[model samples]
Target: PISAAAFGVAGPIVNGVAKITNLSWTIDQIEVAHALDLAADKVQLLNDLEAMATAVPFLLPEDVQTLNTAEPVAQRPIAVVAPGTGLGEAFLTWNGRRYVAFPSEGGHADFAPGDSLQLRLLNYLAPQYGHVSVERVCSGIGIPNLYAFLRDEKIAEEPQWLREMMDQVDDIVPVIIQHAFDKAAAVPICVQTMEMFAHILAAEAGNMALKLLSRGGVYLGGGLPPRILPMLQAPRFMELFYGKGRFAQLMAQIPVYIILNQRTGLLGAGYAALALDESL
Candidate 1:
């Protein structure tokens, strides 16, 4: 019998009901309690990013890898950027006694191009999506969109073999990423797609760091980062991250890390449940 439980949902939880984004399900806290046979007040729901942010304080050293050497300032705001099925954003700041995580839908914000190539890509995508959001070119779904742009725009050639592989897979992101890292595959288009993905992700992360002034640190959490660790470590990613003209120096000093532990969201929910116990 469970005494307490917390869920990290993919969308905002309003009035104890979460209309899960990218999916059709709408979850209610009361329904969850009934399904689990737990007390009504024992269940807590949070945005996925909020849950991940909450788990930041509890992360063990081994759970993360430093992407940059900038030191963290104690008690300062912490920022989280995740690109999965959809991009997610959140932050945590001290509220005297504890760090409170705040969820945001910042991923849906307009995509801002930083270079000529990005500007061209934006023009290419604008017709299809009236408002190109950061999530449109930065998440799991975004990979294919970028891949298509590279292929159709003649930026890169999509070989017949790669086309066949993409045709066989329902989700083309993995196929593209796999071939991108496979030097033997000789798939230049796939590799270029991945590079573009890293560039956009890094740029967005830097944008978040600046927006929040997250001096505590910026944590990258998602399905993409861990799998593409090699790419993220390369100079290209860092170049884009610190390319903010006026803020380059400040960007270089903000600590950055990739969350290696995949269970961060669940762990955060567990911590939230424990907090409820203490409060009670």
Candidate 2:
């Protein structure tokens, strides 16, 4: 018989009910147990990023590409930040027996512009969003928002073909990303859009490392990071990451990597289930 079960939701879980951030459905532990014909106490709910953090220690070298190897201090806290449909943030800390994942809503925090261009972009978005969060300019949706800024603000020309292509597509995020990676006949605006995305992402990641003092390392776990490896490797990304005034040296010492395994969250949930069963 199944002794326990675990689930990683893409939102906050409170009182055994998960209010998924991007989805309409609410996940209740009791409902999940009743549906599966298991005891309610045997099921556990965790934020998706938290579950992904659980799989960090178990990830193989081949599962990640190191951007920095600053020598992670053993047993120190580790941070995970992902930008997909929405941004997600989490951390893991050793608790004697094992590392425990802690979920956070840090992604929704206010967006801090790092340059004049970023400030202009923020001003452009302020009217539309009222309170521009990091997720507004860092996630999948943020790509288009950034793209629109380039075009609408006269920073880049928006050709008719690109406009038509985007209008016909169900999701312009992937289309924009594809054009960004296409150097041969690339759309200049798309390329710039992705560049801006990388800048903001790197900046936010550095902020996360500083906030948590994650000397264990900072891992990027998201659908976009792995696909945009070349863009991420650009010197501009690291430059922004190391832009911290007095703490640039400390930021330079923080190891950073891209989590290649997309199943990290599921794998972490499995470990959570094992942990729960062992305790029982």
Candidate 3:
């Protein structure tokens, strides 16, 4: 167990050097050893996204659900995006025989809303924050903020039961989603909340793929995508994903898959370890 994770973009020391990202605390190998109670040489650090990206090619065929129908895995640039603590973006390149993956801080890119509605939402969001990054709007952790925004915007009404239920918890998206899927406690307002959430997500997904020009396909591999599996309306999601004006035609041809397996991220980490080992 880590006694404490302290750093400023410095990762664990591999050969006496590392950059851990979050900066609440900054410590070196000795500090890490003292904090974690482990042999300094035994502890290791790896970039979470880099580790996950390395696992793409290794994903078992059945682990991913194809959204668009295309199989150009070997011929072009392959990208993976995961929405964890923040949006993690990575891409891989194949040159006939093998692939190499690279990590990206592209998740921090400014959020560009596609339509008047999105712009309106941004206008509402901008006043509250410095710069509205996509992670500020699209990730699961970000969803509740949007929910409150919507609630305040009067886009939808929350019933008393739902309001009280929501007020009792820090995050209401997951519970709301489960309610929606169960059709048990999901009310009219809850359904509206999720629908709005989904639309924003779709728009972001489209923007991400377009920016990458990932012709091979886009696989939704984040923690949230699978939980909302019961509600994923491909046509609706596609409508928003490919809604870009000039590039709609091109975006339509690309494939998309949702990774169903919960262990995919872990698999990706293992794959990266093997790759790093092979390199050594």
* Model 3: per-residue Cα lDDT over 1-280, one tens digit each: 3322222122333453565656554436566666768555543344556556656777778888776655554556667767654676777777667776676776778888776766877898898887988877767766776677667888777678778787789777777776666655566555665666667777777776787787766766667777776555557877888898999988887777777777665666555444434334
Model 1 Cα lDDT, one tens digit per residue, 1-280 = 5778999988789999999877999999999989989878888998888899899988999999898889998888999999987898899999988888999999999999988988998999999999999999999989999999999999999889779877887999989888889967548998988889899999999999999889999999988899989999998888888889999999998988999999999999998888776556
- lDDT of model 1, residue 1: 55
TM-score of each: 0.95, 0.96, 0.80
**lDDT values for all models:** 0.90, 0.90, 0.67
lDDT of prediction 3:
0.67
Alpha carbon lDDT at 93, candidate 2: 93
Residue 252 displacement in candidate 2 (angstroms): 1.3
RMSD of each: 1.6, 1.5, 5.1
Off by over 4 Å in 3: 1-44, 278-280
List residue ranges in candidate 2 displaced over 4 A.
none
